[model samples]
Target chain A: MIAFISSFISRVMNTLFKGRKNIKLGLYGPPNGGKTTLANRIAKDWLGEEMGTVSAIPHETREIKIKEQVTIKSGKKELTFNLVDTPGIATKIDYEDFIKHGLSERESKKRAKEATKGVIDAIKWLDNVDAVIVVLDGTKDPFSQVNLTIIGNLAARNTPVLIVCNKVDLKKVKIKKVESAFPQYPVVGISAKFGTRIDEFYEALFTVFR
Target chain B: MLTLEFVPYHEIANLSSIGRIRKLLNIAKQNKIVLLEGRLKKEEEIELIKTTMEEINEDFKGIELAVIYPTKNDSGIFTKMKTNFVDMIAGNRLGLTIIGPASIVKAIKKDPTKIQLYTQELKKKARKKK
Candidate 1:
């Protein structure tokens, strides 16, 4: 009787464990769309720390950065995700471009090569991501090669997407335009730098990403 | 208060990425500068550019677009030079990207050199001089 009871209890424990799902949430976007900044913001809010460095140069983050077991709570409901912050995706990576960003000839070439590889790595990771948060620069035109590719890949894979319009603090912000650009996805406009409208972003995060 | 043409404000949250590009092209076809708030995903941007190129012939030669971001650093003269007009206009993944008429873009670029760099930095030699 004790052996039978133990087996029954084991089955019950398995069922309980299966009910709690941990998602792999991804951050994807073009170079310098503030993916790291937004990643840092979310990490800071929930994990009490930052994940990666932010820089003025493009492709500053050329590695797959992850923060495991990040659990966010909204009242009684709580969700946990393994945050995966990937490198920015781009169609082109010219060493000359990095030179324009003040890197030396050797450094620019090295960075460009790494960035290209990073783009490939980021694409390969799409299959593993449960959902994605696309971070975009608020003041820029939303229609571009990089932005379209990321959204298209996500749609093709049937992964949920949350588009974050970062840098609303800028003077020329047109969040409505971004809202219009990707009418299908939930677009949250926040100054990730200053944490403006971040609460709304978090609330939207729960509703949309969940 | 800004209305997004046919897509109702609330309903926009349901339009697919393709639908948004369609709407964007329609607006751009009218010769209006479509200032999209956020940077686009790579594929969406690619399709937009491809479809845009295909549609260009008589009425529209191209479209002019730019991406703007808030000042991150107090950029020094050298740093500004690094991302100078030639560099930023050409290399920025996001920046003041203009894809419209060459004539208009030319007029826009007629006096780019006059624009001031974000912030100034003391020259290394000047520091030693002082």
Candidate 2:
């Protein structure tokens, strides 16, 4: 009976202490900016979760998609990340999809607007987060307003921004200009679609977080 | 009303690390409107802005926070975060803050005369510097 009790108590303690420390990281960018694709890669490679849906349409993520807990290890350090993937930035949206998805269009629109506000919230989350990953499209001009604004805001918040230049495999994409543009910040060029830079991306995250 | 102009660091030749540091120190000394333009990701820009603000705050008793973006469409997650950070930092201080896009189209849409006057003053200041 004493051995049985000891085994039960040990089981409970093991369950409680087995998990790593959770680090909340938010994936944020403009509409259809490969944010989801990168999120899926991170989730699958680090957390062992199955890949989520990927769509070409903007605002594909109308709500926050969260993967509760996934453990990632770097050397002797272990961290559990509660990765939150947010909706893309959109000035306006179509209500039909929201209704079809079983949510009110009015409410969805409100949520969409709130999603923009979530960017601020995400920055504030930096106070608690270990690091943040900012995804960018390599195919587009790096000097665009959205990219600059996002980078500027992140700078103001004092959050460590890891610029992931995604979609590098595309024929039209060129990383040289992008690399030259933001010399002050660390940037990792990756092709999220084909998982070309997945290893390097993880190494960068570990370096930053560590 | 602190105005900041962000320029790509690589665009400026002979802009060594020390030169950039000197420029920042000068901006701090002048209490002038400063801008930080670069083709950075959201996180990189935010980190730079925050560090610069902290540096400015260290030198000046209560420096205002203002972020100028090139276009209205550029206003997104990062912009919202900037406003929130400004509000947070402004809460205990004198609290002068302005966060918006610096696009001509947006300015004209809101108030052409005000934007024109502002631009005129900037150009005049540039001429004086020249």
Candidate 3:
């Protein structure tokens, strides 16, 4: 009788203590949607370092980048998770597009090829991540194929998602459009570049992951 | 010869993710390779891994999945022609992934020159035992 009671108590304690630690939080979105910018912001706020470089050109992050041992606290709640910043997901990747941006024929084609490989690497990383943040450009329409594909994939895994409507520092950004498009998930608007409304993001992160 | 059925991405795209994955698993269990055009939906891929892991048994081992992409290069007209031709027919040819029973892929080698994916037949003993 005493052994049975002890086992029950131990199991309960394990469940409670296993609250949240070493979580893998992934940043996923289309090209130039401020994903890396947000990753930098999060890392700068916590770890005092940048995750990866960002560029106006699409798919600048042509690989999966990880920042480990990040711990964030909001009021009484705290989250410790590895931040995984992935390359943008695109439906059509054309080398010609890169050439149009004044890159050399050789350079553009090379970037396009690397970017294409990066998407597959990012998608493969999906299985291991604990949760995902689907970052979107608030100025653009939220109903693009790449955006829908990302959400659909997240939905399929039933991964807890926090939709980030980024680039709100721009005057054209419409947070409502993003919210309406993905009504099921919680949407938080922030200018990751300018670090606006970042505290709310931290609070929401605690809420969503809690 | 690789004994596998081609599941057109458009056909499988319409099914619920679970249904699509279940359908893919059925093909894998039949001891045949699955040449799927395009890529599986993100969720479908994730669920496919989960289901594949759960269904491991004596008859089947694990899955060996591969994506085939044309060698990408920047300088030559030949490279441009090949890249454009593949894109016109296969959409994003880079997105194509091949999934098959691991029993066959274990012995074959990646030649990088000849056949990109060398699909061999499963062992006779494993099939006969079942």
Top candidate, metric DockQ? 2
Instruction: Write one digit per residue (lDDT tens) for candidate 2, span A46-107.
Output: 76775467766455665667786766776786556677776554322333335566667676
Better of 2 and 3 by DockQ: 2
lDDT accuracy of residue A101 in candidate 1: 81
Look at candidate 1 and tell me the lDDT of residue A183. Answer: 60
The best-first sequence of candidates by lDDT reads: 3, 1, 2
Per-residue lDDT of A1-56 in model 1, one digit per residue for the tens?
A: 43453344334434533555767889998889888998899899999999999999
Ranking by TM-score: 3, 1, 2
DockQ of each candidate relative to the true complex: 0.06, 0.09, 0.06
Runs of candidate 3 exceeding 4 Å displacement: A1-20, B1-130
Regarding lDDT, does 2 or 3 come out ahead? 3
* Between candidates 1 and 3, the lDDT winner: 3
Q: TM-score of predicted model 1?
A: 0.58
lDDT of 1 by residue, B1-130 (tens): 1122332333333567788667767775664444554444445565555455445443354444333432222356766565565445543233322223321221222112122112113264257678
After superposition, candidate 1 runs with Cα above 4 Å error: A1-20, B1-130
lDDT of 3 by residue, A1-210 (tens): 434533443354345337656678999998899999999999999999999999888879999999998999877776888999999875335565577888898888678667767777777788888788899999986765457657878777767788999998999999987876676677899999998999989987776665
Best prediction by TM-score: 3
